[model samples]
Target: MIQTGEKELKGIIPGSWHILVKFWPQIRQRKLLIGSSLFALLLETALGLLEPWPLKFIFDGVLLSRTDIYPDILGFARGLSPMWLLSLLAVSIVAIAALRSITAYLSTYGMALAAIQVLSEVRSNLYSHIQRLSLSFHQRFKSGDLIARVTYDIERLRLVTIKTALPFLANVVTIVGMVVVMFWLNWELALISIGIFPLFAITTTNIVGKIRKETNKHRTSEGAIADTTSETIGAIRVVQALSLHDMLEENFLIQNTKSLQEGVRSLKLATFLEGLVKVLMALVLALVVWRSSLLVLQKTLTPGDVLIFVNYLKTAFDPMRQISKQIGQIAKAIASGERAIDILDYEPHVRDLPGATKAHPFYGSVSFEKVSFSYDPSRQILHEVNFDVEPGQQIALVGPSGSGKSTLASLLLRLYDPTVGGILIDGRDIRSYKLDSLRQQISVVMQDSVLFAVSIRENITYGRLGATDAEVEHAARLANAHDFIMDLPQGYDTIVGERGGTLSGGQRQRIAIARAAIRHSPIVILDEPTTGLDGASEHAVNEALNRLTRGSTTFLISHNLRAVEGCDRILYIEKGEILERGTHPELMAQAGRYAHLYRLQNDTNEIEGVKHVLEA
Candidate 1:
């Protein structure tokens, strides 16, 4: 979802007005449409106020024949017969309603269009911002929740903008116009009609805060449900193999039930407010009718004046009832808008500095100068690590799991900067170069290289976008992936499933190698690239890797000592420090940690090989 600052999260939730102010820039972009909509709204409110007056004139002048009290604006109607006057007033009512309907349509359509355009742009920008956030930030948050904020939360805001905001604005203007007219008709009756407003305001104000709180709770619960569903679906194969259905379902059901409870609680508060508004409105109506009847009997007011007063009261109070009914939805939209604002306001922890410039073509000399790093302060992952690799050299880093071998590769690529020292390329600190330019000069193939659900050609071209079809095929061939790709029905055009699930482990690794090959970067990193593959697949992937990294500065992080035996130099690291560094023969001759591990690994391999022979 939106990445809120710690301090911002602890503060009070902002009101709807504050949310609107935050989004005012986007709204201001559509000023022309908003202006036209406002004009239409004013016109529509004017017509609605005029609606009851036609009937007023008919009651007082046409039926009762009260010409003395007739409005000066309608003096011409005095000369007409009662039948003609009644006919004219009826036609005026229909005319006023038709005009009001047209204006209403114009205003509604304009606002809805503006809302859609503005929100769609906001959604796109949020998605882009999320992608650029630091990898640490992504690891800390659930992807499903982020998806919920980008899609569902923004959608909630759009719906409220169209369905609730427009009507609320129109009703506000109508209320103001009706109130002014009511006072003009009779000051005493107007006072009685509006006297209940404070009670209505107090009732709504007291309950609205609770409704908003419950809405926030409901939204949080929904996000949790989304995270659960996303995590389960992403690892469906593992869940099915492990028989985790019942356990996962139980967790999902808890979130679902909590969401329902909070949702219903918010709705119940809104409903109570609506019922309270109706009661307050009824009280005002009763007092106005009773007082107006006495005035009519005493000849202080005309029958038509009483009729107009009651009509205005009902019209004015109707908007209050509608607002009360919609409080829950409005609160939900405000919560969602706050979430979106939080993300947009967040600055990426790692971004290009003001003076950063494009990096020049690198000769692939990499140096880590006393570099120390950690994902968190509680535990350091890498400590005082010093190393250097010349251009065109192949270095192997053999370490136990979690010994920071892959983290060193990550630091070289600038995914995360070293906490205590600098990484330099071609003798220049990497931070001096723009992030995108620096990263473009290096390539990586992780143990589980991810591929999108697209054609094989498209996946490879992602390494260096705009690579031609011929270049893609050449890269595939270099990686030893061309034969199997061609055997497929669609050749290079064959679509891969998500994460390349449709392909065998060997085939996926070969495609990933091709992607790295197409980049043609001077620096390459292979992190356990053949970890889980069978012997045949491992051999094929190793062959392809050799072709791809032929002239590049390559750092190979692997557990299999056999692969490292061929590298020009090998570094045996443990506990975030390089324990030994030498050529394979030299390390073996020294009989240090590297020699001990190498002999143990080879012994295990020999035993496994003999067992395989006997079984055959």
Candidate 2:
């Protein structure tokens, strides 16, 4: 189950220690909870420390003859006569039993409550940070990977935080308290009992460190599987349409296999480490017994003292084993900490300039001053382009695919900034305005306008949240969506399926248009708005489009030259530069690239007409 690469990693003691030290702030907060938890552990450690004294007293004072033992055996049994020894023994046994019950209840609950509180805070913060990352980051990371990190990897921390880790720490303090008391009573016996610790540390570091790294790999593999599943399911339509279901399943199985292998390997290594701890405990016990017996015979130590040391030796390994068991959890926690920090530390590519303020309500005059852009630093997607939109004017951008039409629209919306130049709204550089304020001045509809899975009313009013019912209806009517929305079973209340899949393509486009219409921004950017519609549907939508475009600074991007012909001016773009710029009739009259394309379309239509005439 464990990968070979992970198994070969040498244990680095200092590095792991530094990782813990660096995260001391997180530890301190947990320690405050651990302190509350420590209160209960104090009673448990005290009960354990007190436990040995009573037994030592019983052995020396009553069973074996010793003068000094009387001071430790607080309650008297011998003074009450022959019935007294049995009564005292029974009371001593009951006292030890009662102490254990109080120890269990107080220590476990206090630690459990504290761990959960920290987990709650961590999950909330991590979730909030994910939301703050830009849209581009989300596009690059798989949905399933992000989901698994937040839910699965984070849950591993939660499991260890409450159940395994804090308890182990509390017990370490308990074990230290036990050792201090044991050495105070008899240093020679304590030293003999503790000799196996260095060996235990060696064994634990080798096995647990290897296993901890593998556990992280298993978590990563699980994320890959989840990512594949999420992607497949999200695009279920494409998968079914292309008959890729079996291929996707095979891919998922490959990732799942790796996860399963790591999980099994981690389990095996954990079991091996636990068994080694038990073996070390036995060895230490045997050593303590052999050493203590010789002291007893030489009269350096009494039989009573030898007996208490034997019990001490048996339980002394508990803390070492406790720490060894928690190493995997601590390692996983460090891994989670690294991921959460990566997100919090990353700087956003776009940040508003210092002292930036809101752009006042737009006057619909958008100007590009030698604007240029590139998604990557090495290649330019747009050349230095200059243009200006007169207030309330309609301008059209005509181009083939990859001519930077969509990128131009994106810049206007402030989805991205130009690499080499600034965009000015009215007379001000857009960068000087607050980001949200800059975006608010423009409303847009792309070729594939997205609608959420919600009611028709909700879809239309998405552009302006908190819009009144009357406003929602008005926007729908303005986009020519009111008649169809009324025709649906529930009128405005009709629930649109996911991405408005329940509606026809043209219907979905209209709903998206209505959403854009509701914004009522001064600048409207329509990017290939009616690309795939039927002739009659395009005519119907164009009627609503005409109503929406009026009185706004409308910038239209379309592959269809006819769609832009009606605009006041058209910019025929080729590559990164504008090939021509004029009103549609002027471009047609100029006999350039625009005129050539127009003639081809006219000839094709006439040819189809001639064939029909010949057939009749």
lDDT of each: 0.87, 0.76
Worst lDDT run of 10 residues, candidate 2, spans: 1-10
Error of 2 at 279 (Å): 2.8
List TM-score per model, in order.
0.87, 0.79
Model 2 alpha-carbon drift over 4 Å, by segment: 1-144, 209-275, 296-313, 316-319, 454-456, 483-497, 534-540, 600-616
Tens digits of lDDT, candidate 2, 1-616: 1232232222224434553464455556778666766776777767765666556656766667455555534445446443365457558767876976687676777677765666666667668867756655777778887777778766776677667666676667767876786687678778866667777767777776678678889999988988888898899999999999888888888888889999999999998887888888878778777887888788777777776777766666666766765655555565665565566566656667799998899988888888888877787888988888898999998877898888888888777788888888889988889987877668888878888898999887778889999999998888888999999999999999888889887888788888888888889889888888877777777887888878999999987776677888888877778879899899999999988887787788789889989999
Residues 290-315 of candidate 1: C-alpha lDDT, one tens digit per residue:
99999989988888898888888878
Candidate 1 weakest ten by summed lDDT: 1-10
What candidate 1 gets wrong by more than 4 Å, as runs, is 1-24, 68-70, 201-281, 614-616
- Among these predicted structures, which one has the highest lDDT? 1
Q: Which candidate achieves the best TM-score against the true structure? A: 1
